[model samples]
Target chain A: MTPLPTWQRGMRGWWRRDPAFRRYLLREATSVAIGAYALMLLAGLGCLVAGPAAWQRWEGLILSPVGLLLQAVVFAAAVIHAVSWFRLMPLTIPPLGRPGRRLADGAIHAGAWAASALCSLGLLGWLVYGA
Target chain B: MTDPETILIEVLRWHPDTPEAPWWQSYEVPYRADATLLEALQTIKDDLDGTLTFRWSCRMAICGSCGCMVNGRPELSCHLLLRDLAPGPVRLEPLAHFPVIRDLVIDQQDFLDKLPAVGAYLVPAEETEAAAAAPAAPSRQTPAQMADYYQYAQCINCLLCYSACPQYGLKPDFLGPAALALMARHDADSRDHGQAGRRAARDADTGVWDCTLVGHCTEVCPQGVDPARAINRNKTASARDYVFDLLLPGRRR
Candidate 1:
């Protein structure tokens, strides 16, 4: 006769308990902030298509403290998303596979960060300084 | 020699014959500076509790048989010195994400099934080439070519990476780290022509696509085999294959 197997229950608290798992959970949660920002932009676009009455209401919502707080949260999540995404680029697309064309992880990370900074700065400049 | 100093060890206990469910059993083990954790278990089995059970063979990291959870991390019991985990009350359990066969032993059938699923073995490019070549002649491999897949080849199949992977805990069918790393190891090998055959396992939703690049597997590996690196690197390869498959369905090289 065979002995019955005894199974141990796994904890759902791994995200809260483990430091590595917590970081992974936080990285995944950034998508919520991105989705929130996308919805906000879509609302603004909808208001524009609906003309002045709807546009005024959208403008009020955009200028509200709550709206500003949401934007701040979204911006913070985007920055984290960008940094973590760039950090993972070295692993996803490695540096040393090719002969005579080796690049360090740091170089890859910095290149990605710089590209992101340039794109962000250009977009900010266009938003504020464009006529 | 003076009477050996003792330390407490808490090992998870379970038996099919016993009515009680799994529970921790603590033992006061005589400490020795040079003794590995496996030695402590041996002492417990020999002197203290003969009923206590765990698996170990090589008494070294090479066999990959002595893997268990120490302080919530997967490590080979034979590889860790008891002196390092001193000050009493070291917690021991079966490897995470695997069903316990008994005390510190886990049923490794899940891992065994995945090995063949991913085409873990190398497939020679030509069956006739082997017949034509001299029996004693060595297959040509430059130092550079050897280095490409050398790191991944060091995997001891300890399932330490599986225990470290949260993705495996969540989705058992994800073809977790060791198997995927082995897949990438053979895929990267210049001599192996098994990449095309392993494509189904690699390209599936449960393949490299499931890994979110947590990288804990690499950190916990006793042999320093970076399965996270292999999984993520293959993500790039998988993406390329996806694009190519779409562009030229029948023209894949």
Candidate 2:
């Protein structure tokens, strides 16, 4: 008997096929911006170590329009990354709370967001008042 | 608006004997507000085209036999009402990422083969000879223990998750969603002592690590089984295991 040919529908642009796929791609893409921000921070540290003059030069460049725009994009990506990460946090961990009474997913999200907000505010306050 | 009395269902048709590639064949099925897509397929098979092939059983969404692609989304045919997809053409095709057996039927042998590898069933703890000889009492579980695995137990083996998974489409070697979810189901069971044995499968390259958490599997699931969560949680477990194995080689389980 001849072997019947089964139609193999290849995955061509499968990531673009669905909204869920697009969202997953977006979540994964956030890491690129986060990586760029980390590199920028490292570069700043390098500038600081070099000299005050080098530090001033780096600061000026960062405060420029293009740099500010890049920072804004990075900030947006970071926010997206954080939110998506927190949303998926509950799934990665074991059921919270005492046995027979697990914490709701909302509780985890709330806790995560609260912690993030507090940290962001603390950093802002320290930069404004102490720095 | 187009005639509400009848709606066109565009079905992808193919046969191995025919040399022609798979093509769309439209059937104008009588519209019914309450009728399901399965019923419409039945109408086409019974009255319109007897040659039109598909699979269906226990039409109320149980038995998991009637899953197919509806409007490019993996869905249970019996669960979708014709009214919701009213006024025009609704595309019907075999589930994505699978080889079409015929019109609406895709070969599920791949998924079926992965089931046992993931250890989808409970593995009873080893018992003493005395205990084995004695009458086996039913394993009782607390509400908390049951809750750990209850949601995962709702999986009906519908294969919609496979269809929704782009990773599975791109790489067939990956264990995919439903199987991994089933692995999680058993791993979470209080009575199951098979976690160690199943760990290798879940910890492999083709395991939970393969999933990008697209989460369409959960969305497309008729039973609400979150395969993404199941697979992702296992990734955490696998990572922890990897760290432990690396740090304490002697204590590796």
TM-score winner: 2
Candidate 1 whole-model C-alpha lDDT, 0 to 1: 0.86
True contacts kept of each: 0.44, 0.65
Residue B244 Cα positional deviation in candidate 2, in Å, after optimal superposition: 2.3
lDDT of 1 by residue, B1-253 (tens): 4434897999988776662677889999999989999999999999999988899999979999999889888899999998888875789988988887788878898889888889998887655766467556556777777777888999999999998898899899899999999999999888788888888899898999999888889989999889998999998888888898999999675
Query: Runs in model 1 with CA error above 4 Å?
Result: A1-17, A94-97, B1-5, B127-138
Query: Which ranges of candidate 2 are over 4 A from the true structure?
Result: A1-4, B1-3, B129-135
Q: After superposition, how far is residue B204 of candidate 1 from its true place, in Å?
A: 2.5
Worst 10 residues of 1 chain A by lDDT: A94-103
Question: How is the predicted docking of candidate 2 categorized under the CAPRI scheme?
Answer: medium
User: What local lDDT does model 1 show for residue A56?
Assistant: 92
Worst 10 residues of 2 chain B by lDDT: B128-137
Q: For model 2, what is the error of residue B2's alpha carbon versus the real structure, in angstroms, after optimal superposition?
A: 11
Clashes by residue pair, model 1 = none
- As for candidate 2, its clashing pairs are none
lDDT string, candidate 2, B162-240, tens digits: 9999989988999999999999999989989999999899988899999888788988988888998899989988898
